[model samples]
Target: MMNILLLYISPGKTTEKISKALSDRFEADGHRVTRLNIGKPGSRTFKEVGSSIFYDMDLIGIGNPVFHLRVMHPLTEFLDQALPYAKPRFGAFLYLTYGGISSGRALLDLSNQLKKNNIPILGGFKVWAPHFYNRVEYPDIEARKTIDEFYSRIKESGYQPLEDEKTKRLFSYQTRKVNIAYHLANVIGNLRELPIQFDQDKCRGCNRCVNECPVGALTMQKIPVRDTSKCVYCYHCAAVCPHGAVICPTEKVADMVRTNKKLIGVENPQNAVYL
Candidate 1:
C-alpha cells in the first residue's frame, strides 16, 4: 500500500477516465488517493507557468516551445516544493492523450527532477484516443489497446518505482533560450481559437460536461456558457457532450491538412515535467 497522488493534466474525458481507473485500483489495494488536476489559475498561461515553474505547464494546453520554456524554470521550482510536501510512500503519473503526443523537453526535465528529488515514480504512459486539440479523425485502435495493456502492466507490477537514466539525460540542454523562443513564435502565428459552441435545441441540460469538467468552467442551465477564465482547454466537456453539440469552432485546422498528411507527433512543452 502507498500514499499515491495520481497527478494529471488532461483535456476532457482523459482525466476522468484515468483518475477513475487509478482511484479504483489504488483504493482496492488499500492506498490513500487524491487526484489533483494541474490547472491554470486563470486563462493566463504565463501566470500559471510563472507560479509553478518546476512542475508542468504543458499538461493543460498545447503551445509553442518558446512560450513553454519561458515558464519552465519557475514551474520546476514549484514542483520541487510539491514533491517534499507529497512525501509519497509511492507515486505514479499517467498522461492521457494520443500515443505520439510527447509533452516536449519539459517531460524529460520533470522525470529527472523527480528522480533527483528522490520521489519514486512507478511509471508513466500516454493514453491514446481522440485528442481534444483535434476531433476524432481515425481512432488509433492499436494505441487504445496498448494503453489498456499498459495500465494492466502497471497493475501487475504493483507500483514498482524505478529510475530511468536515459530519460534523465534526454532533456538536459545548455541553451533552452534560443530554441524556446523560436517555438513560441511559431505557436503564436499558428494560434487559432477553438471556442466551445453549444446547440440549445439539442442540449438536454444533463450537465455531464459540467460535472465531469476537471476545471469548474461549465455550468448547466437553460444553456451552457463556458467560463473561458477558468477553462483549461481540455476537451472533456466536448467528449462527454451527449448531444454532440460541442466542437472546435470550425474545421479550419483540418481543412488545411493535405490529403496524404500524417498527423501523429509528440512534443513535451518546455515547462512540462513528465513522470
Candidate 2:
C-alpha cells in the first residue's frame, strides 16, 4: 500500500468533502492517507513540501477552490520555498471545486504552475460545488462519478503519470472563454482588502471566528480583532458566529449564490476527470 498525501484549501468545507470522498476511495484500496488543510493556521503547506516526508509520499493530491476564476492557493510561493528539497517522480493530481458553474482557467492555471515547479501532474478532477459554506451538496451524483472514474484510472495506471497526449487533453482544462469579472476582482483585491466588521456589543466572546479562521487572521482581544491583510474574505466568521456579531455584506453574498445557482449544470463540461 502507498502512503498518500491529500492536501486541500477549503474555507467552506465543500472541497474537504471532495477530498474526503477521494480519501475514502484510496483507503478502501489499502493505501494510507494523510489529509491536511494547508489553509489552516498550524497546518503550513511548506512544512510538508519541504520535509523529507514529502519525498517519501507515494501520491500527492492537492485540492483547491476557484475564487474569482483563479485557483485559491498561493502554491507557487509555497513551492518556491519547498522545491529545493523535492526529488524526482512528483506523483501528483489536482482537485478543483468552483462555486460558479464554470471553473474557467482554475485547473489549467494550477497545472501550469505546478509544471513550472517541475511537478508531474498525474491527473486533475473538477467539480461544481455549492458557493455557500452552510451547504453540503458536494460529491453530488456527478462528482461521485468523476471521483470513481479518476481513482480507477489512477489505480490501473499504477499511479504513474499517464501518457502525455491523454494528460494534455483531460487535465489541461483549456478554454477560450475568459471571465472579465474574475480579472477585475483579481486586480481590485490586490489594491484593497475586504472589510470584516465586528459588533463588539453583540459578541459574547465565544471565540469561534478567531479559532475557525483558515488563515488565523483574527485574534481575541476584548472581542475578535481582525488583520485585514491576512483575511482571505471567506466570510466564514459571519457564517460561524452564534450571536450574529460578525457583520458582512449579506446582500452581496445572496446575489453571488443566486447567480451561481441559476447557472448550475449549465457549463458544457462542469465536472472533469483527468487520467
Candidate 3:
C-alpha cells in the first residue's frame, strides 16, 4: 500500500468533492491517505504543511479548481512555496475541476511547475463541474466512470508518465486566441477589485466575514473593512456571511453566468477529458 498526500484548494467545494472521492478510493485500495483542504480559513501555512510532509509518501495528488483559465491563487501559492520541500522523484498526479470556460492552459502550466520541481507527472484529469457563478449538476455517471478508470489505472501501473503525443494533443486544444481573450477578461474583472461591501444596517457586528476570510483581508471595524491588496478574491467572505450583509459584483457575475451557460449549455452528463 502506498502513502499518499492529496492536497487541494477548493472554495466552491467542487474540487473538495473530487479530492474526497480520490482519498476514499486510495484508502479503499489500502493506501494511507492524508487529505488537506488548504483553502479554508486558519488552515496550515505552507511552512507548517511542508514540515509535516512524509518523505516516504509514495504518491501526491495535487488538485484545484481553475479560475480565469488558470489554477486558483491559493493553490498556486502552495505549489510555489511548499511543493519543493517534498522529496525528489516522488510521483504526483494533477487534477483540475473547471467551470466550462475551457481548461485553457491550467494543466500545462501546473505540469511545467511540477517538472521543474523534479516531480514526475503521472497523468492529468480535467473534469467539468458547475460554474461558481451558477449552479449546475455535475460528476454525473460519465465523470464518475472516468474518475474510476483513472484511479484504477494508477493503482495497476503505479505512476505512468503521460506520453508526448497525448500531451501535444491536449495542449493543441488551448489556442493562443483563447488564452489572450480569457486573460484580458480576467485583468479587466480583477481591476475592478470587486470588494465585498458590508451593509451597516444588516451587519450585526458578528465578524463572520472577518473570521472566515482565508487571506485575512477582512477586518472588523464599524463594519467589515477589506484590504484589497491582501485579498485573493476567493469570495469566501461573501459566501459565508449569514445576514446577506456583503455585496459583490452581482451584475458582472450574473452576466458571466449567463454567458457561460449559453456557451456550454446546462446539459446533463458533464464533459471531462483525461490524459
RMSD in angstroms, all models? 8.5, 3.3, 3.3
lDDT of 3 by residue, 105-222 (tens): 7777887778778777777677777645555555656557768888877667657666655654664454664566466556544653565678999999898877666556778899
| CA lDDT, every model vs. true structure | 0.48, 0.72, 0.70
In model 3, the worst 10-residue window by lDDT is: 264-273
- Work out the TM-score per prediction: 0.53, 0.84, 0.83
TM-score winner, 2 or 3: 2
**What TM-score does candidate 1 reach?**
0.53
Model 3 pairs in collision: none
Q: Which ten residues in a row have the lowest lDDT in candidate 2?
A: 185-194
Top candidate when judged by TM-score against the true structure: 2
* Per-residue accuracy of model 1 over 134-252 as CA lDDT, tens digit each: 54543245544544565577667665655576345433432354355336433532443356788888888888777666556787778788988766444557667878877654355
Give per-residue lDDT, candidate 1, residue 202.
Answer: 84
Can you tell me which runs of candidate 3 are displaced by over 4 Å? 88-90, 133-142, 163-172, 191-195, 249-251, 260-270
* Poorly placed runs, candidate 2 (over 4 Å): 45-50, 73-76, 88-90, 163-174, 179-181, 184-195, 257-266
Number of clashes found in candidate 2: 0
